[model samples]
Target: MKLIFSIRSYDWIDYAAGLILSESDIYHVMILLKDDDGSMCDCKNFCSQAIYEQRKFDLFNVGKKLGVKKLINLGYDADEIDINKLTSQLQLYLMLSGVNEVYCQYSLPILEILKNICNKLNIKLYFYNIEDRKDEYLMVVGKEIRLSNDIINIKNNLSNLTIGRYTIVVNNETKERFYYIYKE
Candidate 1:
């Protein structure tokens, strides 16, 4: 069983199969709205328009013909229905349909929440890196004082040295350390 996540711009819609619906394979098609920020406004104002609505209807009709059991809307801010809550709801839906796998675009917070949900439901969540086409990387910094290896070596070798945005600290016994001002 497969689960599908639909992403339009920054909003995400997660869908799982239901007992009434059974599809062997699930496909996640991202609707790329041509606009700045492409928020819910895009879906409400533009997508709901007659022309776009027809297009969506056609797409859904085709998907139905192709045996798509569920359709999910993903990417919008879930302030009221946040990621954790949404995933919990989706987990129940997937469980009813016997879905085992989920496919989705990259949304770190949502992905993390979904991971937890999947763990609880014993389902596997799969993430597709859509941003890789632009060559982007996401980094998480754990500490403010963690310095690069080069900066550490330099601070260790020199009693007092200053590198770009880094301050080298040298101990009385000749131990070397690096420090940087907290950016806060």
Candidate 2:
């Protein structure tokens, strides 16, 4: 299965558009790494709280738009960058879930790290960039190509789908807990 693993940001409309327009059977599994610098000052600010809430709300809407099957968050922060922990977690998930293709949105060292991980795990990796958002139908990283249809605005087409929301239940076959779309 294909997995859309995003981090740090909730900009998923472009990814959703690529999948929809291509008619590819790709399941989005957003892995939100909580690397927020939880400073006391930042936490205490009212603006910060409001922005957090807004971000959460936006994430929900984006997930719904993408029909995300699972949203995983690795809680807490580390004092230092623990490559082993990060690699193991990602590898375990990919192995367990049988994910072959990983479309990721991350920056810097993490991007390089993901590349190495995907390479080692024998999985296809696509660097998902919001800047190259709707221009390319398929997420071919580094390729600059305009989408044939200028009239088609992808963001406008994102309508929330109506389906029975399922809680994270253990899959009998895989023995893995899956959280489908959240219920309102």
Candidate 3:
């Protein structure tokens, strides 16, 4: 499957890497950034400039290991484009490229935007939020899709994994959910 990742920082690195590594059917993975400098979001990152640079480098290195196929910058500064234009561009890109899934992290506004676009395109969108888990064990809840066998393998292989009860949520709700846990 083809996937698009809207990235902002290294916060989602472990989840992203885990998903990519576990899902062997991935054929093309595109890294989408909001700016040319590789720092994708307009939000303030907590680290120093030097540390930020290193994080970007480390992120790319991890992507290389995960076999990411393309890196694309949308080329929109904070003041350069409006939401309608951004939405249009994203819609056109995903429609043209036939992207099957979209993975996004860090920014809730961006996630909403992508969620709308993906819903329109009938593509599955997964939001990776590291802070949402209950404890040491990662939790996943999905509306449409189920946890794959690969995830089960990860759960079984890890000795340090904390057992936590998680239920797969399916309802008439419009939102979707997916969570991945892996040791770095």
Winning model by TM-score: 2
Q: What is the lDDT of residue 79 in candidate 1?
A: 40
- What's each prediction's clash count? 10, 0, 0
Candidate 2 residue-wise lDDT, 126-153, digit = tens: 7665353334344447533343242144
- Tens digits of per-residue lDDT, candidate 1, 5-41, equal 5444212211211211323355444332311222131
Return the lDDT, model 1, position 157.
34
Global lDDT of each model? 0.42, 0.52, 0.51
Lowest lDDT block of 10, candidate 1: 158-167
- The candidate that achieves the highest lDDT relative to the unseen native structure: 2
Can you give the lDDT of residue 98 in candidate 2?
Answer: 84
The segments of candidate 3 whose C-alpha lies over 4 angstroms from its true place after superposition are 27-56, 75-81, 130-134, 143-184
As for candidate 3, its clashing pairs are none
Order of candidates by lDDT, top first?
2, 3, 1
The C-alpha TM-scores of every prediction are 0.45, 0.58, 0.56
- Ordered from best to worst TM-score, the candidate numbers read 2, 3, 1
Better of 2 and 3 by lDDT: 2
- Candidate 1: stretches off by over 4 Å: 9-52, 74-81, 134-184
